[model samples]
Target: MLRLGNPRRRIGIGLMAMTFVLSIFAGRLIQLQGLDSKVYAAKAAEQRVQEERLPARRGSITDVKGHELALTLEAREIFVDPSEIPDDRRDQVATILAKELNATKQTILAKLADRTSRYQQIAAAADPAAAQRIMAHDLKGVGSKHRYRRDYPGGDLAGTLLGFVGTDGTGLAGLESTYDRLLAGRDGKQIIETGRQGQRIPMTHSTLLAPIEGRDVRLTIDRDVQWAAQKVIADQVEATGSRTGSVIVMDVRTGQVVAMANAPELDLGNWMAAAGADRVNRSVTDVFEPGSTNKVITAAAALESGAVRPETPFTVPDQIRCADQVLKDSHPHPVERLTFSGVVATSSNVGTILATQRIGDEKLHSMLQRFGFGTRPGTGLPGEEAGLLPDWKDWSGSQRCTIAYGQGVSVTALQTASVYQTIANGGVRVTPQVVAGTTGENGAFTASPPAKRTRVISERTAREVSAMLEAAVSEGGTGNLASIDGYRVAGKTGTAMRYDTRCQGYCGYTATFVGFAPADKPRLVVLAVLQDPQEGHYGGEIAAPVFKKVMTFALKSGKIPPTGTRPSPVRIRAGE
Candidate 1:
């Protein structure tokens, strides 16, 4: 429809347009391939490569006989990448995850709402089957990682002693916390290249370091004995409606703790659900007045210092005056002549005070320290409290006499048990030990060092105290309930006013009975303590029976036959 121009000129214009366009494309390609190559590659690498942690296997906790108490099992940690989940599909994916993984839908939805985060942990220690179910849905951004979960095979047995682990697999309490370094080992890591969907890119995985597995911790606790002790103490606590209770059984010669049981046991599998107070290992942590259980120490001091003999007589009455407090025997009685052994047999608070006057406060204080009072029992468990032992110089006027009768001084169940263990071991105090040995990652077994020993009294003094304790368990004595038919038993009963912080003073009673078997040749010492019992609060009434039950079991289990000799008659009445 128009006049034609020069054909060569039209062709040249078209060629010019095409050349400009190609030139611009070529420049851009060169810029991308050369000048900005490293920058783009770095950005791509940032999106494709990810660091992953390889969890180390936590060690096993076994009892003396190689019975596993706590262990680690393989598990999965489910996670989600909010960036990969579409806004419209987030609710659907969250719903699937909540149902399959047993997680809260609201929690999963909250994590899915954060589109900026590439990784959000949805659940830890998740069951492999649950993780598999989650993956079956092919929900975008949902994934899982290999993890190690801590499990207590015994459930609540020795739960507080074995302690618990945190979500990150770190020890949080008890022996687990005390020996975390040995049990946690070393965690390793790996770097891998991933695809757009966060899938592992084959042949691009590299482990930066290999994980080191934790070493096994072997404890001196006997699994069967522990179970028995726990059963008995837990039963007693329930029957008495006690606020708390504890039992300690020690190998007299070795100071190795056979069983340390507490009531309302901490169930390791559900440790988080337990209250903080219930989580404590009260045997070593809680402190209480020893009550009459401390009388044995007074007897030891008096016998050791040559201030009194088992036959020495004291004129005792219902009550005596000391400082501003009137010290009295547990029960009211008229003035009566009681021999030194008789005073112990009756658990006479007044007689003990009169006898304590002979050695004086300083000597008694020294004796308490020698018996491991006011010191850590060295059981190697976490939260071990050195019982409160005030220096004699700091004693209030009333404290002097009260402490003499086992009221002012505070001692832990372990410390009280150690006192009788000293007597049972013939006056030599062995440091209490919980851990027996350790098995290394390389499968090497190493035994714990020998327990430290100290002589608190002469063998003769220990024997004298032992005889007095035997008298205390004799017929018509305070702890007569602790007597066994076949074997001679020696022990003391204690009923002290419990100190309560909430009350800011004494509130309830702490009943205790500590004793050993085969009076002639003591082998094992068992101590049972009950705090704030609603029923009977007398050691002989409630606590002594527990001691007898545990001791009978331990004696029969250890096959320790009696000395085959009748207990020597100690005159309980002065006129006799």
Candidate 2:
């Protein structure tokens, strides 16, 4: 207490006080200038220099004529910085976003509750109107980014073939799914200065790398033909009260599918509302007993194996008994003798079984495989099923007979069309090609090589089978309704019983017709398949007429000239 009075002690106390104050200041200066400098500089840089990835635009899907089937357009995606949102207005902001973006209030609230997060996705690919509404409000913390939105301008035109894109910009079906790799491009990046609210600072120096667009996919589909097919099939399906229907149009020479249409189309814009089954590409995915339409394969096998000739005679009965099942005609009639050509022309189940019996199961299966049954058509469409064709070694007596007439075995519309394409192409089975190739960034097109081809039968056999098919479309044949004036048309009619899970057996019928026009030198193969029709369910009654209209339009549009002469008739002599 008396130290203040002493000179020496007072001098020492002054020095000590000076040293303590200097030490405190020096430690704070070091902390501010050295230890925490990098941390502070980084924080400053975040507000001045922002790095972000630039999204790449997805590719377009086009028809052979460069018509857009699917594409991408600039659309707004809503985002947010929860930290920038004022606490007092949080509920108000959430309510506004929920109404404009069609999002849940709870979702927006949860996002707003995270005060630490600087970024959050509020909505993806919102329409322009919604973006406009949000901008009009000019609310704080709400932001938008322009991103590519997958679009199908033709509505459901080629929905099954063009497929769809998901919210994350990935292909999910059809050709889109098949060639997704080439369609999704690489993203880029940019480093720029941003304000606290995440807006770009004006006139700030920045680095940017531009995004590359995906290659455009050019399909072999003819938009006109596709539209016609889709319209006709949808109409017929609704008229006949069928559950579902599909149509396929293909170029005979190239095995390129011109159109693949399914009824009650799956609209790409509203895909989420469509039933999963409706979105299926029935041309390749769904299998049905081909009914009498499969007779062409049997006829080809018989002719190729030299088991029978067009003039070979068969005494067809109304009902024929196999091992355990009785095979009967669609309508009952007395026994009548018909030529091998007449057997096919009439779509006679008994006569076809008799013809196939001569060919044997092994020869028949070989012919079916050669015709591209029991395998994918190699069209590049994903999820394609190799329609159920069991081996000859597993065939029972009834199975053999039923298979001969297109029952007990299943096939897709694609396989059925390929069979005719094989015959039309002179027995060489060519793989179906969906995409022609890709369009380069320079706007140059690279053509894809034609798919592999295999000779399924000799020219002589193909010609013979084709002639039999011609007679099948003749005046009195079952496919008579399929004929078009000024053109020589050849095709088969099919009406097969459908299996019912409710009863665990055959119940309803699936009608089908597959035909080509200008039969002498065919150019187009068109097929119409109808499932479970309530009225006039026979192939000839329902499917053939539709085939005629669609094929007529296709032939006209394709500029195919009519042949001057109709095909000569094949006469069947009565049994002696």
Best by TM-score: 1
Residue-wise C-alpha lDDT for candidate 2, range 314-401, written one tens digit per residue: 8999889999989998889899899999898888999898888898999998888888788888876877988988999999989989
Score residue 469 of candidate 2 by CA lDDT.
87
Count backbone overlaps in model 1: 0
lDDT of 1 by residue, 1-576 (tens): 898999999999999999999999999999999999999999998888888788899999999989999999888999988998888998899888888877789988999888788889998888888888888888878889899899898999998888998988889999999999999999999888988876789988555888999999999999988999999999999999999999999999999999999998999988999999989899998888899999988899899889899999999998998878787788898998999999998999899989998998899999999998888998767789897899999988878778876888888999999999999999999999999999876799999999999999999999988998999998868999999979999999999999999899889999999999888888899999999999999999999999999999999888899888988889988987
Candidate 1 ranges with C-alpha deviation above 4 Å: 1-39, 83-96, 136-140, 202-205
**Highest-lDDT candidate:** 1
Q: What lDDT does model 1 reach?
A: 0.91
TM-score of each: 0.92, 0.90
lDDT values, one for every candidate: 0.91, 0.88
